[model samples]
Target: MKTLGLIGGMSAESTAVYYREINRLVRERLGGLHSAALILWSVDFAPIAAWQAKDDWDATGRALAEAARRLEAAGAEAIVICANTMHINAPQVQAATAIPLIHIADATAAALTARGVARPLLLATRYTMEKPFYRDRLAALGLPSLIPDAADRDRLQAIIFDELVKGVITPDSKAAALAMIDRGRAAGADGVIFGCTEIGLLIDPAELDLPAVDTAIVHCEAAVDFALG
Candidate 1:
């Protein structure tokens, strides 16, 4: 298997999910205790979050580009940025490395398309939801998406950063998220996109009425496919 480079630790929580899922997929596919051959460059999230708050994406991109260079020098065949919000730096990382970057949006878009979901309600951090990078990428892929209203977007952002990243899961937050989904359904959403990697921890796709695409899962699956090839 080719070594997959993972740029992670936007929050330690979701990176754990990516690590576990990627290894599980490799074992399931190869059998006999097989696992992924991968490298992880886990950054300190505090400064990264601070930079994001300050809207310093240029610094963000440069730092992640450096990480990509290190991973490439360390012999990674491909790179995966484990956080959805950090993909804003994807172009920088891609340019800094010779290997492929397994993009979360591309994986999620493909999954949504595979399920015949023309329009999915996207649940993510304010950066991902409000920013044009993610949505514009999906639209370019021929799958437009819906985000919650401004008020609910604020609530969801709080739930993600304050609760989910800290490993807090409350019944109230889950119910509120469901209500947002219901509102999206009323708004004509045909499916759900767990746009945040950590969202799968809060909302299970199995419980939703609409078809759901968990970006973390599909992203891991795509990475595994690349590694195995």
Candidate 2:
């Protein structure tokens, strides 16, 4: 198996999930006693979060590129930025390394396509929702995106940063997220993309009637595929 490098800790909460899921998937695919060859570089989310809040993507990109370089130097054959929002820096990271950077949006788009979803509601950070980076990727795959309205977008952003990222999952927050999904359904979304990595921690796919794309799992599976291939 190839070594999979991860740029994580955009929020340790969801990064932990990525770590677990990747290992679990490897073990399941390869059978007993088999696990992935992995290298993880967990960064301080404080400064990264600050850069995101300020919309200072240049600084974020520089930091992520440096991280990717370090991982590449350590012999990682493929890179996975373990958070969806951090994918804004994916191109920069890819430019800094010879190894592949498995993009979260592209992975999610592929999953949505396999599930036959054309228009999925995207629930993520304010940056991800407001920016064209993610939506454009989906559009490139012939899948248009449906986002929550302005007010709902603000609420989702706050919930992700303030509550979900911090590992505080409450019934009220889950209810609020479900309500947003309902609104998206009303607005004609055929499915939902838990575009924020932390969102899967809040919304369970089995509980939802609509098909949901959990980006963390999708990205993890893609990394595993590349590693095994």
Candidate 3:
């Protein structure tokens, strides 16, 4: 199996989920005696988050690029960034690494297209939705993505940064999150994407009435395939 390199700890909230899903997938596939072939490089999310919020693309890209290079040197077969928002700098990071940087957007785009979801609602950080990087990539794949309205975006940002990013998940927050997702569904979206990596903390497929896409899970699925397949 190839080693899965994780550039994780972006918010730490969803990094845990990524690690768990990868291990779970490996165990389920290999059965009973297996953990993932994994190498993890945990980043200090606060500093990175601050830089991202400032739109400091240079510093943000530098941080991820450094991580990618180190992970490559550490012998990761392929690297996956653990956060959705951090992919804003993925181009620079991928260039810094020798191995493939498994991208969440690409994985999700392929999944949604395969599932016949041409127009999906995207629920992520403002940087992810408003920025054209991810959305343009989806467009290139002949898929469409919709961001939440201003009010819903603010709500999602709060749930992600103020609560989920801090490792806090509550029943009330979960309900509010599902409510926002419903709003997106009502907007004529075929399915809603848990585009914020940390969203797995507060929501799940079973909890929602609409079809859902989990980007972190999608990315992990791709990583596991590359590893054990």
Residue lDDT tens for model 1, 47-66: 89889889999999998999
Report the lDDT tens digits of candidate 3 across residue range 1-229. 8998899988777888898999999999999889998899899988888998888989989988998888888889898999888888988988997788888988998888777787899889888989999888888988788888888788778878888889888988888777776777778888878888888777877666667888989999999999987
Task: Please provide, for model 2 over 1-229, each residue's C-alpha lDDT reduced to its tens digit, 9 standing for 90 to 100.
Answer: 9999999998899999988999999999999999889999999999999998888999999999999999999999999999988888888999999988888988999999898899999999989998999899889989899999999999889899899999999999899999999999999999999999999999888899999999999999999999888
Candidate 3 TM-score versus the reference: 0.95
Best of the two (1, 3) by lDDT:
1
Residue 65 of model 1, lDDT score:
99
User: Which portions of model 3 show Cα errors greater than 4 Å?
Assistant: none
Candidate 2 off by > 4 Å: none
Give the distance in Å from residue 135's predicted Cα in candidate 3 to where it truly belongs: 1.1
**What TM-score, computed on C-alpha atoms, does each candidate reach?**
0.99, 0.99, 0.95
Per-model lDDT:
0.94, 0.92, 0.86
lDDT of 1: 0.94
Among all windows of 10 consecutive residues in model 1, the one with the lowest summed lDDT is 44-53
Q: Which ten residues in a row have the lowest lDDT in candidate 2?
A: 82-91
The count of backbone overlaps in candidate 3 is: 0
